[model samples]
Structure formats: structure tokens, C-alpha cells
Target: MAVEPLPEPLRPAGSGPAWRLRYLSTSWNGHPTVASGTITLPAGTPPAGGWQLVSFGPGFNGTPDRCAASQAGTPPFIRPLSEALLRAGYAVAVTDYEGIGTPGESSVVHGPAEAYAMVDIVRAARRLAPVSRRWAAAGYSLGGHAALWTGSLADGYAPSLRHVGTIAIAPTTQWGLQFAAAGNPAAPVNPAVPYQGRTLPVTHPGGFRAADWFTPAGLDLVDLAGHVCIEQMAAALTGLTMADVFTDPSAAMGEFTALFDPHEVPVRRYPRPVRLAHGTADQLPAVLTEITAGQLAAAGTDVIYTPVSGADHFTVAAAIAPQVVQWLEELFRRP
Candidate 1:
């Protein structure tokens, strides 16, 4: 493990000393990879059992090394939220996900790769700071998806750590269906779909070709997805619908489903309680979270599902941050 001070932009003003970490984690294909993250603790002395930890996953940041949270500026919604978690007396550890910072193409939404990075960062944080064994996994958007996977995988992947719970805000699920909708001219354009068009192929095991999926116009913009951050790629692909980009969105639908299906969360029963929150107005659709929660509940996982009235994808995290902190407090209080 390697530790260094966090960059100025990523360090919240009132939070305690924070650091950037490069540690080992397993990739989706079961290969060892170096992962990076940021860790911030609450200011002042530790509590009796040391500060409880929240291992966090930030939303999509594109698939380049420069997009890693620790490398780029603070990710969307991370500063205020991290500060809030700090005020609530929890140490925060945010993973860059596998390959974003260290090496290779990042598996944009692969759950196993993300779960490994999330859980391992907690172990890395323990080495550098005073942290309680009891910790929870939390995230927003793409990070939220990672949190669900972490909740399902942590108990077996890191059996020694006392994982208390999981909290997902506007988490993504059913990605294959989302991608399939790209063929619908009526379906609203989502920049992420084009962005993933380039990334998913790079990381897929079957060696799928981006050329097989994208139109000439999309090929021009999606190439940026590999090189720039999400916002930049979104800007470049703005005003273009998926049909405008994909030759036939359904042309490679079966292959895309095969690649993305295993990445869906709540695939297995979570050993810990899971708090799932989504905004009714989120572009990703609230029904996705409802379906995931239903599956988890049916499998006997203790699930707490909440739907925010008007929150959008970007605002859902702030909408439920306070309640989420309270949920964490109650979860950690258990014996």
C-alpha cells in the first residue's frame, strides 16, 4: 500500500487530515490490480472504539486514469457529502474503482471489480488511521451500484471486517435494459450510453469491438470516453440521441446483455441491512431500484427502500444525506 496527501481540491476544508491511497484489489476477471482512493477522518481525537468508517463509491467518472477521484478534482457531490459524513463523526474512504488510477481499462460498471475495490480500501484505511472494525459501504449513482455489490460481497471477501450495512442513493441497475432502450428514438438521450459504448468493449472478456456497435458520429464522440472524463464526453455527445450514435442499438444487444447482466446488483442476498433510496424523477428511473429492492427482499435481505419525491439523479444524494447518516448511526449502534 502507498499513501500520500490528498490533492487540494479533493480535501474538504473542515475535514481532518486526508490522504490518497494506492492499494491492491482484484479485478472482475480475478486478476490482481492496483486501485487508488481517498480517505478522510473526522477532526479531533478518536472515539472509544475508533471512528466508524464509511467506504464510499462516487458516481461515474469516465474510464481514464485522470478521472480517478484522487487524481482529478473532487468528484460530483463528493465534497459536501464527505464533509457531512465527517461532521457526523464517520471516517470516509472513497475508491477510484479498479484501473481508474493505476492501470488498464476500468470496468465501468462491473460489480465484482467495484466490490473488491470498495472492501479493500477499508482494509487499507485501517492500516493508515484509527478506524473501527465496524464499517458500512455507501455510494451515489454508479457508486451506489458499487455499494450494493460491496454489501453482497464484503462478508465473504473480507470476512474479518465488521461490515455494518450498505446505503445506495440513486444506484443504477438493469444496465442491459437501459442500453436496449437506446434503440428507441423516443428514449431520451443519456450521455452515459455512448460513453459506455467505448468502455464496455475495452473491458469485456469476449473482446467485443466498439466499431460493431457505434455509428460514425458516435465513434468520433465515444472515443473521447476512453480519454476524457464523463462531463467532457457528455458535452461532446450532447444533442445526439442513441439512435443517432448507434447503427442499430439492438444490433449487439445480446452481447451487451451478456457483458452487463452479471454486473447487476442484489444478485445474491446481502448479509447486512441495505438502505436503498432513489428519486422518482431520476433519469435512470426509480423503477430500477424498486426491482432490485424487491429481489433483495424476496431473497430475505433486510432492505430499507425510500423514494424521494422530486429528487433527480444528481440531487438524490443531497436529498437523503442526513437520513443516510442517521441510518448509519443506527446501524453501527447494533451489538
Candidate 2:
């Protein structure tokens, strides 16, 4: 494979808290793609110790531009996180993922493609910066899933990169469970549900009714249509018992049984440590901490599970930022 040249003056000169934004084309899910982002670093000699790399998977339901380093908001998304990591002396790489920067629905499919993009961005970052091969993955919500999946595939995708560990905050761990919870008519409508791999109905009262879950640009029509189907299915079985929801429970079981069981992938196959943090008060009915811990333990992978007492899905990051940063620093320090 031909190595792409690093852009001119990769890190800006005289950089006391400075960052450079650039775009690079790399292979993701076995296809050539461009990932755009800002690489932040403190003013100095580029850290002679060599920097650690952290690939950040932003939360679901927004375009990458919304989370760009310079985007304005009450709590700036990438800028704050990127600056924090840079202050901690780690080079951070944030991908717009495959679809967020360009056209097409962001692959909520949670398959090899998203996982591959996470790994490739790290590779691209290492080549672009003076960063060490030792690395960690961090993400929130849908990103939490991406980080975990990327960490899971470290051994296979980028064996050369040291897979230190990962930190996933309030991740959607159990897809099957989330789907069941989402189908409940009495359940509070979750804006994030459309990001998952389920179809929903727009007309359903309790379904996704927001114009845009993230911004006011309006919901993507494709995502809106997908949610409509899922909502319809959920409403059809509204008053029925759990057992009655399926005409053929076995077939329903078989469908999800084959696709949603990510734990079956074998933890021994993963080359890095995994850490999961979730809020116990999360409105979403997924047992993220327990499920992730159980799967990792069953597969004999090193896992750390933390459940924030009063935190909910939305507030998980603020509640766990200190601990998350500590864990990330530890991963960077690993030999």
C-alpha cells in the first residue's frame, strides 16, 4: 500500500493550545475514503516521548460538521474533548465516520464497516502525527458501540497498533433489549432510538417525532422512513404480552439470535482491554454495564465495568469524565 504524504506543516508552528484541521484519504471497510478532523497539540517540540492516539467516535444522530472542533454550542463537542486530550499529552483523531461527512445515512448497521473506519482513522492519524502506536478508543452513545467494536477488532484489523483499552460512555450495549424496550407503547420516546437498527413509524404518537434529533436542519427522510416502519411494528403488538409480540417467537428469536449477539464474537480474539461505563438511571432499558461485563468475562477478556449511581444516559459523560480521563491516561502509559 502506498503511504500518503502528511499535509504541509502537519502541526502549526508556535502552538500554545493550537490545532490543525486536515483531510486524508484512507481505506475503510476495504474502500478508499476521506476522513476530516482537527489534530490538537500543545506548544512544544511535538512531545519527544511520542504521543498516544485516541480515536473518538462521536454520538449518533448528527453530522460530523456539528461536532467539528470549532462548532459553536453551549458545550462544544469535539473542541472541548480534543483540547482536553491534547492537554493530557495524547494526540486525538476524530473521524466524521464514513457517511457523516459525505452523503448517505450514517451506517447505524453496526457492522464491519463502522469498525473498520475506527481502526483506519487511527492508522491515518499515526502516519499524520508523531504519535506512538499504543492507542485507545473513546466514544459516547453510538460512538460507545463503535469504540467497543473497534477495540474488539484491534487484534485483526491493526495488530501493529497496541490496543491499550477503550472507554465507552452510556453505550447502547444490548440491541435486542433496546429494540424490545423501544417497542413498548408506554415507554418514553427516546430521540436516539432511530440511530439503532430498527424501523419506526413517523405517525406513531410515541415514535420519533422530532424534526431533527440533533440539529434543526430536519431529520433525514431515509431515517424518518426507517423509524416509521419500526414504530408501526411496535404499535401492532402494543397491548400484547411479550410472548404475543411475535407470530413466531422462534423465528423472531432466530432473526435477532443470529445478528444481534455481538458477544459471541469471542473476547479472546480481541487484543485489548475494554472498559464500559453507563448510568444506572438511564431511561433506555438496556443493561449496558451488566451485559458488557458478562460478555467480556465469558470470553475471558479484561474488562472494567462502572455504573454511575445517579447518572442517566445523557449525563453519563459529565458524571464519568474524571474516571474516563484517568483510565485513558493509564492506557497511554502502558508499555
Best of the candidates, lDDT: 1
lDDT of all the models against the reference?
Answer: 0.84, 0.56
Off by over 4 Å in 1: 186-188
Q: How far in Å is the alpha carbon of 130 misplaced in model 2?
A: 2.1
Candidate 1: lDDT of 20?
A: 95
Q: Write the per-residue lDDT of candidate 1 for residues 1-335, one digit (tens) a residue.
A: 99989876778767888999899888877888889999999999999988899999988878789988888856455566777899999999999998788878777778888999999999999989999899999998899999999999899999899999999989988877776765575454566765667668657745777788778887877777778887887777667776777777666556677888878785656788999999999888999899888989999999989999898987777778888889999899887
Off by over 4 Å in 2: 1-30, 63-83, 186-188, 193-269
Shift of residue 114 alpha carbon in model 2, Å: 1.9
Q: Looking at candidate 2, what is the lDDT of residue 254? A: 48
- State the lDDT of candidate 2 residue by residue for 232-277, as single tens digits: 4334334544233333334433444444564332345356678888
Q: TM-score for model 1?
A: 0.95
Report the error of model 2 at residue 193, Å: 4.4
